[model samples]
Target: MQEATETTHSTAPQLAAPAAESSVRRTVLLAFVIILVALLGVFASRFSVSPRGAASPALLVATQPALAITAALAAMIVSLLIALTLAKPINAVVSLFALGCAFAAYAMQTGTISDFVFLGANFKLAALETIAWSVFIALAAIITFRVGGPLVDVPAHNRDGTFTGEIIHKRALMSLLAAVLAIPVLIFTMIGASKGQAIGACAIAGVLTSVIGRMIAPRAQPILLFAMPALVIGLAQLALAFATTISPDIAFVNATLSPIRVPMPMDIATGSLIGVAIGLGWSKGLVKHEPPSMHDE
Candidate 1:
């Protein structure tokens, strides 16, 4: 018995070594995936907006709307594939945010919002393009959740595929409130002249938005609420930009049309993803309840 116990103790460290090594490898792989996804997203965004080597945002959007839509769709498909086959939902979401971060970084380096600026009829086209991309990406994500539910270990709330009237109403109300509150908070936090400041602002906005969301709807999924601040800020910026075209003479309109301060998709993506994971109490808030698998049953 003593010899058996000694043998078991001696093998424990050997067994643990492989587990630790596997963990490190996973961490490394996740990091690589984040970087790769971010780069790909940036590449896709650049390709979409500047298909013909156009320098002007208005010209690019005006001429290449189809290409823009296609590029955005492709990027989202790639993201969905990654999520379904390689990464957890959380990791996949973080990768999406990394893509947003890449956008923010590029914008910062450019030192101007001119790349994103659109005017007249092109403004409408640009808006349509944005909406198309958003809708496509959202649908892709939904499909991933639905199809890969069991494989990805989707939360019970998401996998259930049923929402009562009361739940819908409550979620909608909370979402509206979060969007309204997020605007000012995002604007204020995003007020800075440097890239680090801009990134920091996004982080702050994400954390605050997550906190606010949790306060208002404690039972709601954190992932659902994470993008609220970014969406609100993006819409506000779009509105302000459109208003500038309507009233080009208005100093306030022109002054307020700073896309540099507006959180890029990735910025909000990264910030909100992390904020939700960390701020909402990861074990409880992120996972909630998982339904049993067929094997378990």
Candidate 2:
């Protein structure tokens, strides 16, 4: 019996090593696929935008809305194909968000949002364009999830432990906490006044939020966790914008509040989607495990 036990123990590491290596490889490949799709989407979307000129905000003024919309559609189609081929439908949805992020980051770098607000440009039209992008991307995500196979249920023990009776409320609270925790990180990273900062900030915020969020709410859906932060940030920005309309003094205060810099909606969405995927991949096996199931089938 002693020898039999020793033999089993000796083989266990050998079996586990290959599985661990395989998991790492899969994660790296997934990250690469997402990054590649995002780059492709950015390239496709930018092809339609006219080159920047000596005039300030010329890029925004020169861009034709119809052409830009067409570019966004083309980018989405390309990203969807690549994501479906390389990953799953859920990943395809993430890729679409990443594409939007890429576009928004570019816009931010070129001072599009600030120009819209301060330059007497048609801010409403710009806002409408953003809304259109969000609606279409969200619809795509919903459709993909619906068409994809149903999500596998986590074992009940893994989902809810000693506090089974209050698990619903606990999950909701933890999810909210996770979103709140992520807000500062997003704001800090995005407050920088440098070009191309939004993309990096979003990526950082997303990964950090997911890692911390998973620890607090292991049973929460990753997508839900990701979305909560973006939703919170987006709503906060909208509220601030509305406040600016109530009084010019409020607008001045908003402009001076460096810490409360407004990021494009797509920036938040992109960060949450891609960051969560990366975080979940990198933090696999690091989270605390629930007790082994007592009711074995």
Candidate 3:
């Protein structure tokens, strides 16, 4: 009976792996469905004025009742899914969402005497702006989980005297890490897609950089940790641009490199901000584990 009990205890984790995978799979599926519905709803809304009968195209394009509403709802939904996965509350996610939106609005806001408000002239673009701006904020929140720190279930020295951070199987650790990383990307991708943007690649790259950086140099300085990936990306873009100038590959450049727009300050800023956030979050996590951190099951 003692032998049987010992065997069961050893095999418990192996059995739990399948259950955890199933839960993750379900969460991903649910998030996907929500995103699809959100996109369909946005397009279905009749916020854009019909171009055929409009007296002024600009005025027509500027008026957007549906888009604003859709964006708010989408933001909330996206934020909630992310929050749930990260083991954070709705309030935290909401704060991040608001910050992102504010940043976008500030960047887009004009200093013109007539139009001092951000995106004031083109309110119709609010949704796209929110989605784009929030990409970094969302990515930062996700990074806080992967290499950020451990979310311990109990104190280091429990009554039983078992340390929570005891070494586990390599496969189990990898699986946990993968699930923790994937959840944010999944939600971020869905949000980006809903807004007709491609910020998914940026998030993926940012997370990977954070993970690899931690493994290679766990004690690296926060600033360097954050800035290195962005620098590498910038250099890569520079190389690509040089290559394009020497080769007659306009088609390839336009198709693949156009969207990345490495020459643009905005793109560089976005990437760098994401990296900094990731590094900062990782450093914080390394310092200590606390409540509200993304729970990696």
Q: What is the C-alpha lDDT of each candidate?
A: 0.47, 0.51, 0.35
| TM-score, per-candidate, Cα-based | 0.63, 0.60, 0.32
Please write out the lDDT profile of model 3 over residues 156-245, one tens digit for every residue: 222232222322323223322321332234333433211113233444544555554444333222222333333444444444445543
Clashes of each: 2, 0, 1
At residue 103, give the lDDT of candidate 2: 45
Please rank every candidate by lDDT, starting with the best: 2, 1, 3
Q: Per-residue lDDT for 1-297 in model 2, tens only?
A: 999999999999999999899778757755766577657655654543433431223223435746655655676666655554433524433444444444443344344335334544433333333344445544544444334322332223344333323233455346546656556776666665343565567667667766787676554444345455555555555455555454323443465633333444445555556666567666656676465435320
lDDT of 1 by residue, 65-171 (tens): 56755664576566545544433533444443444444343333322123343232334344333333334434543443344332232333334445333234354
Model 3 C-alpha lDDT versus the unseen true structure:
0.35
Clashing pairs in 1: 100-266, 101-266
Query: Using TM-score as the measure, which candidate wins?
Result: 1
| Candidate 1 regions with alpha-carbon error over 4 angstroms | 1-8, 46-63, 88-111, 115-137, 144-179, 192-200, 215-219, 238-297
lDDT of 1: 0.47
lDDT of 1 at 255: 65
Residue 17 lDDT, candidate 3, scale 0-100: 97
